[model samples]
Target chain A: MMLWSVVLIPAIAGIAAMLPPMRAVRRSLLVATAVAHCGLVGWVCFATPVVSRDSWFAIDAPARIILAITSVLFLAAALYCVGYLRREEGRTTCDAEEGFLFHNEPEGIFVGCLLLFLASMSFVCICQHFGLLWVAVEATTLASAPLISFHRHHRSLEATWKYLLICSVGIAMALLGIFFLASAGRGHAPGLTLSGLVSSAAAMDPVWLKAAFILLLVGYGTKMGLAPMHTWLPDAHSEAPSVVSALLSGALLNCAFLGLLRGHTVLAAAGLGSFSGELLVLLGVFSMVLAAVFMIRQTDYKRMLAYSSIEHMGILAVGAGLGGVAATGAMLHAMNHSAVKGMLFLAAGNLLAVYRSKNTCDVQGVLEKLPVTGCLWFAGFLAITGSPPFGLFVSELTILKGALDGSHWVVAALYLAALGTAFVAMARIFLPMAYRLPDGSPHDGASSPGAREPVWSVLPPLALALAALVLGVYVPAPLWDAMRQAASALGVL
Target chain B: MEVVSDILVVLLLLSNLYLLAASRITACIQTVALQAVVLGVIALTSAAGGLTLVVVSVTLATMAVKGLVLPWLLRRAIRGADVAREVEPFVGFTTSVLVGAGLLVISVVVAEPLCSSAPADVSAMMIPTSLFTILTGLFIVVTRRKALNQALGYLVLENGVYVFGSSLAIEEPFLVELGILLDVFVAVFVMGIIIFQINREFDHIDTDKLSVLKD
Candidate 1:
């Protein structure tokens, strides 16, 4: 019943949000539902997740970790939405006359779709059946489409189209993979359930299993924004509203990676771990190299952030591939990345609201323009680049140690090189935006009319950044335990 | 029943060729619809032992969605966009058809390994036919300019997966299969809405024009 409520509450609230109502009331629904959902998720994560007899939607350690991260991120984004929407309402009148990017659709659709997106993502986290997991993951793609095109412009439309088409096609391949897995398990009982597959892993046909894993990696890897298939990531992330972008980066990407982790679990159980791990490492390194190349000269701040997301995903993949402590680090990194990236995207949103531009050149002296967001943005950059006194630094170090302990010398070397290049690239873009003096008139509408930073917008990102900071210094025992269990669940132990 | 399934497989292969060679958007949509109907026929005749309620329902659902509903949606998208009949292929029609033939040959060669494992009555052509359909759909998606055609390609790709899925004798639950159909329907539905918006925003649904964001 707890599991059912966690998945169904947002869905019900979303439908209600869509009905005729005041925008304020609907937005309130988003906040209230998010708070309730967060509370429920906390309960489920701390308490032993009540497993159904059939194991269709039970909360495991990994699911708990992902759910906690998603719920926390959503709570912060939901709070930010109230202020973001109010500002948008203020801008729509001016936008109509000025012919700018702020074409306000009914806020109801945006709010509703966001809730549905949460629900689908939650479904992905908790679902125990592989078939249902696939459905939920695909549903996430559908639910987020309207959110991507919330502005309803040519560029957003194109972004939404590419996101929809590319992701749908990729997920279709995943379905093929699922079918292949089913075919491999032809003689097994409890078919397509995660536990069943794990238990019967050794009995499955190797040929089909290999095919299935490759296809699944390509399919979900597209969603995880691995390079070569990551064309839509920059466009969609850059074009979406900042809050939605935060969720996409912090929450949605992890859900896709969770799908890949599921594939890895079965392969590990079957003693075929090396095959999938090697592939993950190759793809991981390639994604990092590509992200490093693109991040070097990127002018759009949001696109640069998107590239950083790709690079971090590469790190997570590499950690998982290296196994042992690296897998544990990968789990910890997943949490840290979500916290830091979520903060950065929200900060980026604030920057966009202030500057009315995504390009780094158009906006300058963020420190002078908005003090809190600037500091948080700087901290976020440090955190994401794995600087000290941040959780990411600890996690990244652990992964590096794991790689060395395993004697993956070349992979470890490339990993460090890519990290260095990415750091330099991000610093090049970020420093100028943070410190350079403003060239344009200080009183432009680009800056908020009063030059006062709203608390609603500033606090959530600050909270997230602080969370990452705290995690860096001391990971709570429960979180460490959860990470261990999650690592072991992937057969690393 | 085996003979009928084989003939349906042949027809499905031919439709892939027609879809590759076809220039008009409406004709392409119709050919995909025809393939969907053939897929339904194959589903009906190829149930492992005999027609169970689950198999019947799956057949009906596939026919309704892939055959009737999706094509209608694509056609509606076409009318809403006021798109030209020309598909505006990136590769020449003759070249694509020749490529399609080559893909068919490759699929057969690739599927040779699986023949031993597959059930005896399952046509030797089933795996190759499905693989060819999937590749052709991908080709259409890659080569075509219009968003609707890309969607049609997606449908073709899905049809191929469905054909492959049914070739296996595993008795998957009806609900799971139904869920798959619903997912495909919704995907096409969402694509249709995005295409309409693209038409409204850009005044043309040519995906080639969607090159604003790049490295």
Candidate 2:
């Protein structure tokens, strides 16, 4: 019942959101549902994990971590949405490409889809059945597709088309992978339940299992924004509303990662840990290196942040692939990345709103313009780059230690190099935006120096950055235990 | 029953071929719809026992949505776009057909090991045929320029999944199967809506032109 409520509550609210004619009531509904969902997720994570009768839905350790991250990020995005929408209200924006004035997508549809997106993501975290999980993951894509094109501009429409088609096709591969999985366990294992697959893993056909694992990796990896399959991510992320981008990077990607991790767990249970682990490491390192190469001199800051998301996802994949303590590190990194990246995107939204352009060159002297957001953006940059005094630093250190312990010297070297390059690349962009004033710069926005930042937008990301800071210094005992359990569940330790 | 299933599988493979060769977008949609109807029939015959409630409902739903509803939607989209034939696909029809033949050989080779492990009742041709369909769908998606054709390719890919899934001996929960079907329906429905939007926004549904946001 607890697990079901966590998935269903937001779904009900999403449906209800479409009915109300007034924007304020709908906005309030979004926030209220987010808060309630967060509370339920917190209970499910901290209290004893709940498995539904017949075992279709369960909050396992990994699920707990993802659910917690998603719920918290949703709450923050919800708060930010209220202020963001208020500003966007009654404003007709001109399309950059076609030069036609257009109102944004209806607020009800936007808010409704936002809530449904949350419901689907939460459903991704809780579903124990691979088939149902696929359904839910696809639901996330369909629900969020509209949000990607909310501006109704040519660029955003193209982004939505690419996102819809690419992700739909990618996830279809996962459905085939699920079929392979069933074939592997045909007449031997009970069904597609996680626990069932694990217990009966030894009985499964190895050949079909191998095929299943590879296809599952490719399928979910695409959604997780791993390179080679990450073609649609930058366009989609950069094009969507920043708050939506935050959820996509922070929550939606993790849902896909959870799908991949579940597949990893099954392979490990079958004593095929090394097979999948090596493949994961290869993809992980490649994603990181690719993201690093792209992050350098990226003109669009939102796209830069999108590349950063791909890099962080790569780090998580690497840590999980390394196993033992590194897998724990991967779990921790997932949380840290969610908090930090979510904070960054929301902060980026502030910059976008103020500067009126995503181009880094177009916006200058953010510190002089909006002091609080500028500070948060800088802090977010440090945290995302895995610098000290932030949660990512601890998690990245833990992963590095894991790589070293496993004697994967090459992976360790490559990981460090990529991290370094990304940090430098992002620093070149973010520092100038925050601190430097370009020579003979035209004022981008009418706001004078030290403009008062909206409390709604500022507070949510501030809260997230503080959370990342707290985790950097100290991880609570329960969370540490959950991370360890999650690692072990994947046969890492 | 065996002959019937074999004929259905053959029809599916041929329709996949027709899809690749057909120049008209409407023709492609009709071919895919016919394949869906064929699959609906296959779903009925492929059930381990004689038809049950689950099998009947699945068959009816599959045919109704894939055969009747989806093609109608695609037709409406094409009408709105005011385009008919695929003027110049990235891969020419002759080349696509050749690739389709090559995919068939690959599918046969790839399905060998899985076929050996499959239960006696499972058709040897089913796995390979489904693989061919899946590859053909992907091929279409990759080689087609029109957004509508890509959408068709996606539908083909999904149909291939259904065929492969139905051939397996496992008993999936009814609700999950329904969810998969519903998801595909929504995916196509959503794609159609987007295609209309793309047509309106860009003045052409050619996806190649939709490349402004690239890095």
Candidate 3:
């Protein structure tokens, strides 16, 4: 009961946020629900793992970790949304005709869908049944579609279309994998359940299991944004609102990772863990190499961050692939990457507000022009490039060490070399963009029209950055214990 | 009775090939509709007395929704878009046909060993038809440029899975079936809405022109 309360409190708040009539009230409901959601997560942090099931739902340590991450991320984004809507309200001059696709209008539908998206992602993390998981994940795609297409421009439409189509095909393929898995379980009565299948995996046909695992990887890999299947990610992330981008990058990716982790667990229980681990490693390395090559030439700052996401997700997969201590490292890296990337993306949004473009070339005198946002963006750039002392830097080093200890020296070296290249590439463009003084002089800059600070916008990422730093340095004993328990359940450490 | 099942397998195989070789979008839709009707008939006829009859009823419904309603909807959408022929596909029709042939051969090779583990009542042809359907789905998804076509391709692929699973006498969880159907409905509906807006904004539905959105 206590475990379920952690998610349900926010879920109720989210639905309430959608029902309120006034825009201001809706925003408050969203923020208040977010606060309560975070509070629930705090409670779950101290609570015991509570399981409730009649052959269906289970609330174990693994699901609790997923619930905690989803709740926390959604809560933070929801708090940030209060400021986003405030900014939006100031800009939109209500006109009926140009609202849905073109206007900077505060749409009722957008607000509703956004909350629904949060609820759906939460549903995905907690659901134990494969059917429930699939439904929730696909529901996330549909609920979040409007958010991705918030601007309603031709380009946004294109992105939403691609995101929807590719992910659907991938998930549909996942269904086939599930079907084949069930087919392999001929003697068992009925359908799929994680625990039941694991208990009886020895008798299951190996060929079908192998086929199901491959389909599962490729199917869910589409959402995980693994290479060759990740064409939709950069587009959707770049085109969406920075807050939405934060959720997509920080939160949505984890839901997919959860699915993959579950698949890996099934394989491990079936004594086929080694084969799946090898495939994860190969895909992870391939993705990192691809990101490194592309990030060097990426002209759009937002898209660069998108590529960086690809890089970090690859690292998580690699850690999962290595198993043992590496799996623990992967678990930490997943949380760290989401927290750090969420901060970076939100900070980048603030930068976008000041510069009014995602292009690297156009903006000048950023630090002087919008000091709060500029500094945050600069710090974000350092943080995500795996700079020293930041949480990401710590997590990456941990993963590298784990990889080396696992006797995968080649992966460790590649990890270091790739991070170095990323730092150099990111710093090359970010520094000049931050420090270059506008030619018009500092006096005129102080008197420039429009709100220069983005103070509301800067705070969320700033708070997120601090959290990332603190976690990198010292994770609390309980969280660390929880992580270990989750990893053990995943069959790695 | 067994002969009808064998003939149904042949039709399913031929449909996969037709889908692969299809340059005219309408023909592809019609072929898929026919495949759906056959699938529905197969579902009704072959109820291998297993765990529950609910699953069989669901399969029959899936045949109706996936095979019938979906193709009809796609056909109407193609008419609305005026994209009757997806000519000059990314992969030409002939090469796709050859690839489909190769997939069929591989599927046969793969299904032989698989049949040993399959239910005794399950026809051997189920594997090849499913394989062909899966390959054909992948082919249409990759080769076609329009978003709507890819959505249809997704349905064809799923239908193949339904046909594949029926032979195993495995009972699909009801919630999963309902969820999958709802997912398909929303997915196709969303795709249709997106394409209409794309057409409205850009005046054409060629996905290549959307490349202006790069980093």
Candidate 4:
């Protein structure tokens, strides 16, 4: 029942938000839905996950961890949305502009689509049937398309198109992969449920199973922003509104990763774990290398963050590919990255709101102009780059240790090199923005008008950053256990 | 049923060539629709036994969505955008046709192993034909500049998968297949909306001009 509510509440609220109502009422509905959904997620997380009788959907250990992260991220973003939307309302007035069609859609659509995004993501996490999971992931893409285009700029529209087209094509391949898996299991298994497939995996046809795994990797990898297929990630992430970008990076990408993990689990059960793991490692390394090269001279800070997401996604892939303790590290890193990256994007939003540009060169003296956001931005940069005293650092260290333990010396070396390069590249852009004075002759450090951020916006990101910090210094035993259990659920143990 | 299957497969492959060689966007859309109709027919004939209600309904749904609904939507999008009918492909027509031919041969070679493993009920040419269609679809997406053409490519790609899926004899739930069709429909609809917005923004729907964001 709680499991059902976890998926249903946001869906119901999404529809309700679309109805003609007071703007305040709609925004309140978003907040209420987030809070209620978070509560249900919490309930489901603490209890033993109850699978439906058919096992088409269930809250497993790995899913519970992801669900908890998504709910918390959604809650934080939802709180920020109240302030963000209110600010946006004061800024834009018209519906259409000369060059752009529907340049300004109603705020109701954004609110409604965001809630639907949450519902679809929830479905992705809980769905155990391969077909249903594919449906849920694809639904997330559709639900978030409007959110990506909310700005109605040409660039955002282009981003939305690329996002929809590339992801649909990629996900279509995933559907093909599912069909292959079904074909593989035709004589062996009763259905395409994960449990059923896993139980009978050993008897499945190896050729079709291998084909399915390859196609599934490529398909879900495209969604997860793996290297060659990651062209859409930077564009969509950078073009979207910051909150939407945060959700895209912190929550949506993880859902796609979960889909890949599902395929990996089946491969593992079928005694083909090594093949899939090597492929993951190869893709992981490629993505990290690609991100490292791009981050070196990135001009747009938002794009930089987007590339950073690709980098972190690479780390998650490498860790999951390494298996055992590294898999646990990947799970921990996923949660930690969400909190930290979400905080960073929200902080970036504050900066964008004040500076009115995403270019690193255009914005300067953030520390003097918006001191709180500036500090958070710098801290977020540190956290994302895996600086010490942050959860990412801890998780990354665990992954490195696991790699060493597994004698994957080459992967460990490449991992360290990529991390070092990313850290330097990020610091070069971020440090100057936070501390340096604005370009051109400034009379003094006179704080610019509207430099102060609202407390509502500040608090959510601050809380998230602090959570990342605390998780670094000390992970609660239960969360640690959950990570372990989730890892084991992937056949990592 | 066997003769029907063979005729439909031949028609589907010919449509793939037509889609490749055709220069006009409307012609391409028509070719895709014709292919979808052929796929619908193939879906009916390729069932292991006489068509059950499940197979009948699935076939109808496929025809409605792939054959009628999607083509109609694409036509509406094209008319609304008021774009040129010429495809303006990145690759020349002759080259693409040759490439499509090459893909057909490759798919046949690739399907050889699978053909040996397939049950007796599965058609000999179904997997190769589907693979060839998928490759052709991907080829169109890569070589075409128009957003609408890319969408047409996506639909073609989906038709290939539908062919492969329908050829399977597993007693899968009808709703799942229906859900897949519905998803493809919605995807194309959303793409149509985005294409309209693209036209409004840029005064054209050529994706080559969408170069604002590059690393």
- Which candidate number would show the highest lDDT if scored against the true structure? 2
Tens digits of per-residue lDDT, candidate 2, A25-114, equal 998999999999999988778887655434988888899899999999999999999999998887588654355887798889999999
* Candidate 4: tens digits of C-alpha lDDT, residues A400-443: 99899999999999999999999999999999998888656464
lDDT tens readout by residue for model 1, A1-493: 8888898999999888888864558888999999999999988888975554457778988888999999999999999999998888743433321255546667888899999999999999988887888889999999999999888777788899999999989998998898888888877646788888988989888888888999999999999998879989999999899999999999999999999999988888888899989989899999999999999999999999999999999998998888889999999999999999999999999998877788899778887778898899888889999999999999999999999999999999999999999999999999999888766555443663335799999999999999999999999897888898888888855
List the DockQ of the predictions in order. 0.75, 0.85, 0.60, 0.71
Candidate number achieving the greatest TM-score relative to the actual structure: 2
Q: Write the per-residue lDDT of candidate 3 for residues A187-260, one digit (tens) a residue.
A: 85244777767777777877788888898888888898888788889999988888999999988888888888
What TM-score does candidate 2 get on C-alpha atoms?
0.97
Of the two candidates 3 and 4, the one with more favorable lDDT, higher being better, is: 4
Candidate 3 stretches with Cα past 4 Å from truth are A1-24, A41-45, A51-55, A89-106, A188-191, A439-451, B21-23, B46-53, B67-69, B72-80, B83-88
Q: What is the lDDT of residue A28 in candidate 2?
A: 91
The C-alpha lDDT values of all candidates are 0.88, 0.90, 0.75, 0.88
Docking class of 4: medium
Docking class of 2: high
* Fraction of native A-B contacts kept, per candidate: 0.63, 0.83, 0.68, 0.58
Candidate 3, lDDT over the whole model? 0.75
Least well predicted 10-residue stretch by lDDT in candidate 2 chain A:
A440-449
Clashing pairs in 2: none
Show the colliding residue pairs in model 4: none
- In model 4, which runs have C-alpha deviations exceeding 4 angstroms? A21-24, A50-54, A90-102, A440-444, A447-450, B48-50
Interface RMSD, all candidates in order, equals 1.0, 0.8, 1.6, 1.1
